[model samples]
Target: MGEPFYITTAISYPNGKPHIGHAYEAIAADVIARFQRAMGRDVRFQTGTDEHGLKMMQKARDLGITPKQLCDGMSSYFIAMCDNLDVSYDVFIRTTEERHHTASQELWRRLEANGDLYLDRYEGWYSVRDEAFYDESELVAGEGGDKLSPQGTPVEWTVEESWFFRLSKYAEPLLKLYAEQPDFIQPDGRRNEVLRFVEGGLRDLSVSRTSFDWGVKVPGSDGHVMYVWVDALTNYITGLGFPDETGDFANYWPANIHLIGKDIVRFHTVYWPAILMSAGLALPRQVFGHGFLLNRGQKESKSLGNVTDPLELAERFGVDPLRYFLMREVAFGQDGSYSPEAIVTRCNAELANSYGNLVQRVLSMIFKNMDGTLETFSSAEADDVLLATVFAACRDELPREFAAMNFSGGIDAWMRGVFACNAYVDEQAPWTLRKTDPDRMRAVLLTLFMAIRDLTIAIAPVVPTSASKVLDQLGIPADERSYAALTGADWYMARVATGEKLGAPVPAFPRLELPEDAA
Candidate 1:
């Protein structure tokens, strides 16, 4: 087994309901965690909601409810979405939790002790909608000559007393850290952008807010509350038992990766790491900024009234197919548009036609000719080559693609296994051999069976429901369906349990029909 691995998705800000973009990040992190677990490594997968900030306060006011009441309702939706999406998180943390508040306070105290925090009056362009401050250069002219944030949210000038973190002091060290660990931030393009921003200069970031009381209070600072990002980021450590320093925190303080959306890459890659450095803590191993999911060629935003509900999509299409299509549709680090047509095409071509057909045909033939029991066969030259290709694809090419977070490429590689198995079936002509040569027929079916087993293991993380279906047809137990247990082994010993009935194999992804307006 390799060293322990840890990963986390950016805790979703529970200002509103969940959307497809939120589901995408959670699914991506879940896939990585599942893959690492299958590799026989101890894996910690954390996810949760960011329940504090100006946005939450505004939302509470809008709803005519307390902040806690707002969070209680909104956070439950986010949590329910994670459960619906099968996010196998080891811990689901909420920034509003007492433990998280404690951790954030301890981090603030440490930074203060190191002279990295100071009391300051902040007067600048602040976006209550974003809970973020923007530099003069970043503010753009909006309608009626008003200023807008970089995210295009309207900004207003605000003056308040706040606690500030000396982010500018660690700019040089941050650049140095990036220089030392080039892979610390995902996709070369994102890393380059962050580096350019830091190289230009850093500003001391406001770490607390006095205007909003719906947040964790800074230690000994009654009026000031810890900033949302500051409070939320601490959940990564708090979930691991930070400040105690004797439990999971000591083991997984520096998470292997913090998976976040491109919009907040700065918070995770730049601000979060600087905060950790200021507090004399190790930074996370990598911060991956995954691209956004666009709806009908436009970014999904609630204000735009174009937010795509993930549950609605899953209800229309199966969950695994939606999960697979999202990851396979985009290159992972570049924004990609979501279209029903594209999804249906992928499902028909890849899922139904390729992977599904391969499994159905293989099992149907085995059930008919072999009486649902496959006979052992020696590995032929062609079988050896196909198996070797599958092994190389998983061990070498798959890792390289996953390391870069190219989930689409990884899915394509997995499909190659399905393609190879189909090709092997064609070349062997098992249908013809069943009548002409019984021995050769068994060999062909056995080879295809092994290939199916290997393919099931490889694609399990992406399309787990369908993979489970395939494995069930083959009568393999769920516990025995691990990747580590599948590779480079004599699969003849693997038996299909007698009297086991194959589950009904319907189309995993039905064709999506777009409404006329969407069309």
Candidate 2:
């Protein structure tokens, strides 16, 4: 086992089906988790649906279904999305689960014990769509003089008896935390935004709601349920078995990162850390608020009729190609757009034509010319230079960029390695060597064989299925496919000793055509 690396996605609110935005966040988090494991870390990845909130209750009423029934049916769609898209999440928690309720109440009890909770009356702007309370200063005037939350969701004035957390008391402490740990909130823009918000001032946060009972009950308070954010945020610790304060809670308590959308940055970075501090727990190492995925150039919405169902997109395009296009096309921590033409052009040129063709041509030639027998061969200066270039990209550049969460940049480095191998194939002209100098040809082919292995392993985290197919043809064992395997010296010779013959190669990433409707 390696050092623990725990990461989570903002649990999806189940008022609607899974969208492209949800899929984008889950895929990014999964890539990070896989990348960490490849770097020799024990990783825990969690994602699920946030099932309790006032919006859910109203939606259930409109459907004439019980809230649990609505949640049960809706959350399954999210689970299926994860399964279909190959999101390797370890836990899929729902706030309706009994364990989650227990964890939420336990957190409340801890806050109460710390004197952070107090009875109060809340009369302010509440956004049902966002499940958030907003201050008068934060509301914006919409078309026709309607008051809206900063997110542009309609706001309603609500009056209720509530319990508030003394968030004001921790404003200075949170500021000090940001100062001491400059990387506590990521991407400088988000961190600076939070800094400005906190510098403006803080107010006591309403932690319990008296208007609805669709949430975790307030401990010993007969008629109130917790604010949805409190219950939803607690899902992070709930998955780790908190309150017991032992086992996983003891080991992975303070998560490495909470990957969330920019729309809810305040909830995760500001409110979450404050809540953790009030409960006397260590804060998460970082909160990263990532940008949205747009359809073409505009944000998707029901009114726009541009909402994309991610599963449908996955079905239209192969999963690996879709995954590749996302990490390759999008600049991490910033907004990116995708359309059918973009997906086809990017995947076809890069995955199908460039890297995939390199794998197919190299392996097919080895099978046809060398009788599929891999053997030790003498290398020339060109062979050494090619290997060194590929090695630097895989072992040094890609890992460095990925560790900093610059995913597009890391893939760019990996593509450079791929391009180098293709260029080597052209320069060596191994086919000509087969007729003129068979021994030199064998050496050239073997050098390419080694370079292909490194490229495959470096990229497996992003496109796992296609990489596995390539590795299978290369006779690389499952256990030896991690990044750690790239540096080991004896694997190739050991494989040659096995006398395993390479099989006929298949196209791992066949070129895709654009759908007619999308065209």
Candidate 3:
């Protein structure tokens, strides 16, 4: 708790409306950030728009407006998406911000002072879609013999005077870093890909582009803008008040984690670290490249007309279910498909039936049988041994999974307890016990309520809205809602007071119905 935890999502390229892909990244990062904060850490979570790029410049021209105006409108859409998804980011940065300009120039000066940067005539294939330069070999020939970047973006041959970073000299250093840290990059597959890339051969990187003027200006260089990647990546440090070299920088610099999409792993794991080393700064602790969200089993693309708007999805099916499906359907580091059907199936079965049903049913029993009051069993242990075991498993395993970045694993572990709670309710049949042995029924219903309370708290990060609703239905006090307040206090911080009547029962996750079109 004493140490600071800094986490960030790669800034979105605000050239268009944000899609479900953007929401996926933001929600994943938010889940972890919320969990760390709930654990009592000083957490700084940042996400923003990468407004300085050739794509944005071209998009602005197409719309017949200044790039800043275009970015201003588009960035608002992204911010709205984050808000709609309940993403808990503390800082939102725009690369066009004045602070970013100073930070980019300062970072450049540091690289220059370290002798890692120099002016050079650059010739390469560049992808405006990617805002990255590619080597000749990295371009693939299409059936029509047109060259495309490795990720299938169209490339153009370009030549200009540019400032270059001596990235070639850092290949060996990066290898040593991978060897020593072993976790500098993540998902094992992505780390190996980066290793193979730097092993294949490292080359000098162009740091400033003379051909573009809609970006951060290159210090002391006329008519030049710093490369979009360089400016965009520095937002991580700029958000921490870098160049000032004190305060947030002194505490939160050297980000604990950079959560990014896999397509940009090379930039974060290789190029970013080399830039940091050149500046005589600490590299981020981890770079995790998570997978993309697919639509109808294919990558979402504008041409395909299948790009799903995140806000629209939230409007149709509420926020917590969408957030839950984003994590629950996908393994943290692998591609996963999204559809209305999948979302409905998961929500109806897991949220509505298992977890949601458990909360409403347990509380309903306590209210109907004990007049909304509860009393703890006097035993040193729970009467239902199996339910106790499941609670213990969730109590011990959910935190461990979150720490390892296995978000799906954490959800699974929490759901395991949820299912167990439901099973205990059915098998014990507290309703029948109420008539036969009313006092024993009180103990059983209270135990079930406690399990519901703890399990809901365990999953609050992933499905925040529903979890909060569940706690409110249980009348959990506000101060005891955080993970620390619950798990930190004696007796695991009981929330349902002894003989205190809970409020009227309300459905947490209402059952969803299939769209008429789906039928």
Top candidate when judged by lDDT against the true structure: 2
Q: Model 3: runs farther than 4 Å from truth?
A: 379-387, 485-499
Give the candidate order by descending lDDT: 2, 3, 1
Error of 1 at 266 (Å): 1.5
**Candidate models: Cα lDDT each:** 0.82, 0.94, 0.86
C-alpha RMSD by candidate, in order: 2.3, 0.7, 1.7
Model 3, residue 17: distance off in Å is: 0.5
Residue 228 lDDT, candidate 2, scale 0-100: 96
Name the runs in model 2 displaced over 4 angstroms. Answer: none
Q: Give the TM-score of each candidate.
A: 0.94, 0.99, 0.97
Best by TM-score: 2
Candidate 1 residue pairs that clash: none
Q: In angstroms, give how far residue 396 of model 1 lies from its true place.
A: 3.3
Residue 295 in candidate 1 has what lDDT? 83
Per-residue lDDT of model 2, residues 1-519, tens digit only: 999999999999988999999999999999999999999999999999999989999999999999999999999999999999999999999999999999999999999999999998999999999999999999999998999999999999999999999999989999999999999999889999999999999999998998888999999998999999999999999999977889998888799999999999999888999999999989999999999999999999999999999999999998999999999999999999999999999999999989999999999999999999999999999999999999999988999999999989999999999999999999999999999999999999999999999999999989988899899999999999988998998988999999999988999999899988996
